[model samples]
Target: KGKAFFVDLTLCTACRGCQVACKQWKDLPAEETRNVGSHQNPQDLSAKTIRLVRFNEVKEDGKLKWLFFPEQCRHCIEPPCKYIGNMYADGAVKQDPVTGAVIMTDKTKGITRLESWEMCPYNVPRRDEESGIWNKCDMCINRISKGMLPACVKSCPTGTMNFGDRDEMLALANARLAEVQKTNPDAYLADPEHVRVIYLCESAPENYHDRLVASAAQRKNLVAAAPKPKTVTRR
Candidate 1:
C-alpha cells in the first residue's frame, strides 16, 4: 500500500513548475542566485531548495542535446540515509511506513558526520550550515495525507511528474518505457525495483545527471562502507 512517483523524463519540458510548486508548498525561502551562463539556477539544491530541475547540455552524435532532470529524493525502500543517520541519533531520518516517503527530521541536527549524505547514492540531502539540520523532498506527506496529490505532481504542466500507489506507478512507468523505447532504444526506468521514485529516462541515466542512477560499482562500495549496528548489552 506504499506510494510512489513515476517521472517521465522524455515528456519533461523543463518549465520548472514543479520546482516552484515545491518551494511554495514547503514555504521555503528562495536562494539568491546569479546568471552562471546556464539556465540552471541556484547552482544546486540546498536547505532552502529541496527539489531541483537540473539542466545538462551534452553532445550526442555530434548534436547538442539538453537534458532536463527534476531531481529529488528517491525514497528508497531501504534508505541508506535513514540507516546512517540513525547510527548517530535514532530517528534522525524516518521513512513513512504507509507511503515509504523518506523524511529528514529535527534530530538530524545532532548528527556530527556527513555520513548520512555520503551514504545516499542520489545525493539528495542538503544541510543547513547554521542549524546543522538536513533537508530533502518529503513526498508531500502532509498534503497526501489529506487526500491530495503532491504539490510538484499537481502543478506539473508536462506529464513528467506522477504519483500514486507503488504498484500503479510501476505499471505506468513500464508502459511509458515500452512506448518510449520504440523511439529511443536506450530508454529505461532508473532503479525502478529499489526506488519509489522511478524515472523513465530517454537515454542513459548518466546522460541526464551523473548521480541520476547508482551504478553497480557504486552500489557495491556503498554496501561495503555501510556501518553495522552496535549491539546492545542487557545490564
Candidate 2:
C-alpha cells in the first residue's frame, strides 16, 4: 500500500513555506526571477522549482475570491511517464511500490524529452538541458523512507498539505470535501483515485489553476504526437 497526500485548498494561505521547504530539502538553487505582477513568483515549474504555490484571483458570485493552489506532481497511480520511459530506458522513470512516489532517475538521459513530457497529463515534468534528465517531486523519498513526512508537508504552517496511507488520505479527502461543500458548493477532490496527491479544491477547478487535472482530449493529442520508435536491424 503506497502513501498518498491530501491537500486542502480551503486552508492554504499561499505563504510558500511548502515551496521554500522543497527547495531547501532538495538543495535546489533559486532562479533569478522578476516580479511578474502576481504573487505566483518564478511563474512556472522548472528543473529547479519542483513545487509552486499558485495564486489566482477570481470573482465568484459578485465576490472576489483568492485561490491558492500548492501545486506539484500528482504521482499517478499508473504513471504514464514511467510507462513510456520504460520503452526507451527501463529505469528512467519509476513508481515506488511502497511510497507511491514517482521518481525520475539519471537514466532518463536515454529517453526523449518530448515523449516523456507528452505522457504526463498535468504537465509536471521539467527537463535539465545540460543534464538531459527529466525531474519533478520525488515526494521527499529521502525523508519519508526514514519515517518522516515530506519536506513540504512538514513545512506547511496551515493545515493544508497532508500525507498518509492511500486509503486514509482518500477517506480524509472525501470527508473534507463533504464538509467544505456545506459552505462552498463548488468543492471537489481532484483525481483522487488515480493520483497519490489529492487536492481538495473549494472553488471551480479552473479558478484554482490550469492543468489542475489531466483531460482526455489532451491525452489523445499527446498520444497522436508521440514519435515512432526507430528500429535497428542486426546484420
Candidate 3:
C-alpha cells in the first residue's frame, strides 16, 4: 500500500517548523536571504529548499487575511514529469511504486531541465546549478521505508501535516474537510483524486497558489509555450 499526506491548510500557522526540519533531515545547505517584506523567506522553492511555506496577504470581507501554504510536490498518482523526462532520458524522473513518491534521480543530469518544469503542474522541480541534476521532495522515502513518518510531518507543531497509508490519509482528509466546512462552507480538498498529497483548503484553492489545483488549461499553456529542450550529449 502506497503512503500519502493529508495537509490541513487551516491548521498551518506558518511557523515553518516543517520547513526547517526538512532541511535538517536532508542536510541541505542554508540559503542566504534578506527580509523580503514578508515573513516568508527565500521566496520560493529551490534545489536546496524543497519544502516552502508560501505566504499571501489577501483582503476578505474587508478584513486582512494571511494565507500560508506549505507547498511541496503533490506526487501525482500518474506523474507527467516522469513521462516528459523519459522522453529525453530514461529513469531521470520516476514514481516509486511502494510509496507513490515522485523522485528526480541523478539520471536527471542527462535530461533537459526545462522539460521537467514544463510538465510538472505544481511547478515543484528545481535544478541544481552545481550538479546539473533536478530535485524535489521524495516523501522522505528513507525514513518512511523504515516505518517512520516523513520529517516534515513529524516536526509540524500543529496538526497540519498527517501521513499514513493512502486510504487512511484520504479518509482523514475527507473527515477534516467536513469539520472545516461547518465553519467555512467553502472549504474543500485540493485535487485529492489526482495527488498523493492532499490539501484541505479553507477557501478557493487558488487563494493559496494559482497552481494549487492543476488545471487542463495550465498544463496546455505550459506545454505549448515551453521552449525546445536543449540536446543533451550524454557523457
Candidate 4:
C-alpha cells in the first residue's frame, strides 16, 4: 500500500511537459514572468505554481553538464509541515495513511498565517491571498486511488516522471542509477529511503537545491521540532 513517485533526472530532457500538465490538470493560473536568463520560467513556485522544472549548468570533468529536476512535494512519511500546520488549525492538513499523500484542507483558512505556511522544508504549501487556504500537490490521490497515473506523469513524454508502489520505484531508481553510472559515476539517488518521491541525480543534490538531500542531523532536528499531536487536537 506504500505509494511513491520517481524522478529520473538523467532521463529528463527538460521539456517541462510535466510542469505544464500540472497546471493544466489543477487549473492553476500562470504568473507574469520576466526573462530570467535561464530557460526556466516563472522563476519559482508560487501559490498558483505547484511544480517547476529546475535547470542547473555545472562543470564536471572538463565538460558542462545540464541538470534538470522537476521538483514538487516529497510527501514525507512523517511530514513536518502537517505537524506544524495542524498545531494552529485542527484538520487543516492531513496525511493519507495509505498513500502518505499530504493534503491541505479548506480548513487551513483557520491556521495562523505565519505558523502554517512558512514551516515546510521544501516550501510546498501556498496560501490563497483572499481565503488564506493552503494548497499543494496531493500526489494526485484521486487519480492514484482510482488506478490512474497522475496528470504530470501521463504527460511526460520523456519517461522522467514515474509513479508506482514504493518498492517498485526504488528498484527502478537503482536500476537506472546503474545505467547512468556507466558514464557518470557520481550519479545517485537523493534521500531515497526517507521520502516517497525519490529523485535520481547525476551530480550532487546541492547542484539542484541546498535542501535536496538533508543531512541526518537536519532531518532529526526537523522531526524532533515538529509539533505534537496533542498540541493540535481541538475541542
Give the per-residue lDDT digits (tens) of candidate 3, residues 28-107.
99999889777879888999999999998888889999999999999888777777766666888887888998888999
Return the clash pairs for model 4, or none: none
User: Which segments of model 1 are wrong by more than 4 Å?
Assistant: 115-117, 215-220, 227-235
Best by TM-score: 1
Off by over 4 Å in 4: 113-118, 226-235
Candidate 1 structure quality by residue, lDDT tens digits, 92-170? 8998898999898999886665644466888888889999998899999999988899999999988899999999999
Q: Which ten residues in a row have the lowest lDDT in candidate 1?
A: 226-235
Q: Quick one: ranking by TM-score, best first?
A: 1, 2, 3, 4
Global fold similarity of model 4 (TM-score): 0.89
Between 1 and 4, whose lDDT is larger?
Answer: 1
lDDT of 3: 0.86
Q: Per-residue alpha-carbon lDDT of model 4 for 1-235, expressed as tens digits? A: 5889999887899898989989988899888989968887877776688888888888987999897888888887777777677776888889888887888889888665354324576666778787788778889888899999999999999888999999899999999999999988888898787788899987887788766776556666765676564565454
Clashing pairs in 2: none
Taking the tens digit of each residue's C-alpha lDDT, what string does model 2 give over 143-216?
99999999999999899999999999999999999998998777888887678999998777788776887765
- Of candidate 3, the 10-residue stretch with the lowest lDDT total is 226-235
lDDT of each: 0.86, 0.85, 0.86, 0.81
TM-score of candidate 3 versus the correct structure, residues matched by position: 0.92
Candidate 3 pairs with clashing backbones: none
Off by over 4 Å in 3: 113-116, 216-235
Query: How far off is residue 47 in model 2, in Å?
Result: 0.5
Of the two candidates 2 and 4, the one with more favorable lDDT, higher being better, is 2
Which window of ten consecutive residues has the lowest lDDT sum in model 4? 110-119
